[model samples]
Target: MRIKNSTVVITGADSGIGRATALRFAKKGARVVLASRDAAALETLAADCRRRGAKALAVQTDVADPEAVEELCESAVGNFGRIDIWVNNAGTGVFGPFLDTPLEDIQRVVDVDLMGVVHGAREALEQMRAQGEGVLINVASMAGIIPQPYTSAYSMSKAAVRALGVSLRSELRLARVKDIHVVTVSPGAVDTPFFDHVANYTGQDTRPIPPTYSPDKIAAAIVNVARSPQRELTVGLIPKAMVAKHKLFPQAVERRMATLTHRKHLKATQPAPPTKGNLDRAAGDDATGRRGRKTGGHGGRTKTMARRLLVIGGAAGVTAFAAFRWRQ
Candidate 1:
């Protein structure tokens, strides 16, 4: 599908990957709608898009609310006359031991990550079915393929998203809607506000991983996926290797994760005052027009350590596997 003049609606477009993607598409001459709870941020993004000479609209939306999602789609269609692409990018994460994590926090993560995607797909499919063409892009994470120790809720939500994307792709095909495409974009540790906004059980500020890609890299990949829909695309070489290793040696992968978790250093630190302006907040909350500062907490530290171990183990596993294959 040609990007120029296409109507695309992006949820969570106030900042981060969604914001980057919105700008990318708008620059390509696509009619773009920026949707999020932050009306002010959405307006800012829309203005920027307009300045770039692309038609744009800002729709204040809470994807967890089915009614809000419905209105979002309606507003997009009302403004653009049709929906060509729907990118379900709005999401939130909570990090803590599954047993210790608040049920409310878990439910909130599930609501935004999993159910939100469901709502976006439902609305986009209905409208696309009518037009006989469209695209749906679900932003999943590397955690979708590999379960993380301290971030069980987040892992579960992403895993569900992966399943949802696969199931929806098949269902759309069965319905004979060949023109409509469903693609999942799995990104590794990207430099986004996701970490800063993640709910942390242990009180600490968010920190960055040693190596992280900018949102622009992810936006570029999403644009490519929209142009040529693939069932799933994994970004980053390390993440791709981890996914492959898990598939070939599930037991070994599980054992590696267990070992890393057991060795993680966790201190009983005072929880930081719960911060406002998470992804769940309205767009105006992110008025800085920048990715939120990442927080480093007990949960975040454990997960970070685990990821480092996984990289080392995954690399070793790959090397061994390659040698074995060569010998064979």
Candidate 2:
């Protein structure tokens, strides 16, 4: 649909990908509603959007609270008449081994990442079904598909997120609601505050894996999808290839991931204490904007240390998978 004068609501709008997506849409003449637990930051972002000539409202909302999310939807419509696009971007993570991670932390991750998407989608779909047209964009991660070993909760949440979109699409089609579109975007490791805010138990400061892409690129893809919605999108090139390889050689890839891929998941930098970073509370004062501080983490290829030996030993196992055959 056309962007100008459209009404859009974005959750988790205070920082990171949500903020970037809000700004991108606002610049296109869309009235934007900002939602997150950080009211101060949302106010700042609303002012920024207003300066860009878009009608803006800041509504502090915690997606985990069903009532708060419903209130968010009412506030958006009360201020702006109708909802044309809803971006379900509010999310948090826990980066630790399952056994070591606290149960509360795991539950919070599900509440924010998976259930949060469910709430946004439900509210948006209700509004959209009434109007007979709307767009819903859910931001899932590459971890959902590839499956990271350490961050089990986050991986499960994201995977369920993908499933949610697929099921929603099927249900909508069955009901003949073709105008309402549900799009799922799977992004690669992104340069966002997520790594900084994740509940870490790995004993070392966590960082996004190598081949990180900017949040702005993701925001752009989301805006594009709003105009021309597709079934699913894998944002970055490296992530696309990774997904392909994993599908072609599941056992081999699982073995590779299980092997010492510490560099792939984290940096050998300073250690951080075990804390529920942003799972329960809003990230304090520093959560106002998109784009996070660059990490000095892995910047090169995730080349195996013993590349020759692994490839040679697994040659027969992977020979059937010609497309995924690894080479030196």
Please tell me which predicted candidate would have the highest lDDT against the true structure.
2
Best candidate per TM-score, number?
Answer: 2
Off by over 4 Å in 1: 254-280, 283-288, 295-328
Local error of candidate 1 at residue 142 (angstroms): 0.7
Regions more than 4 Å wrong, model 2: 258-261, 297-328
Model 2 alpha-carbon miss at residue 113, Å: 0.4
RMSD after CA superposition, every candidate: 4.7, 5.1
Error of 1 at 185 (Å): 0.6
Residue 225's lDDT in candidate 1: 91
lDDT of model 1 at residue 157?
A: 89
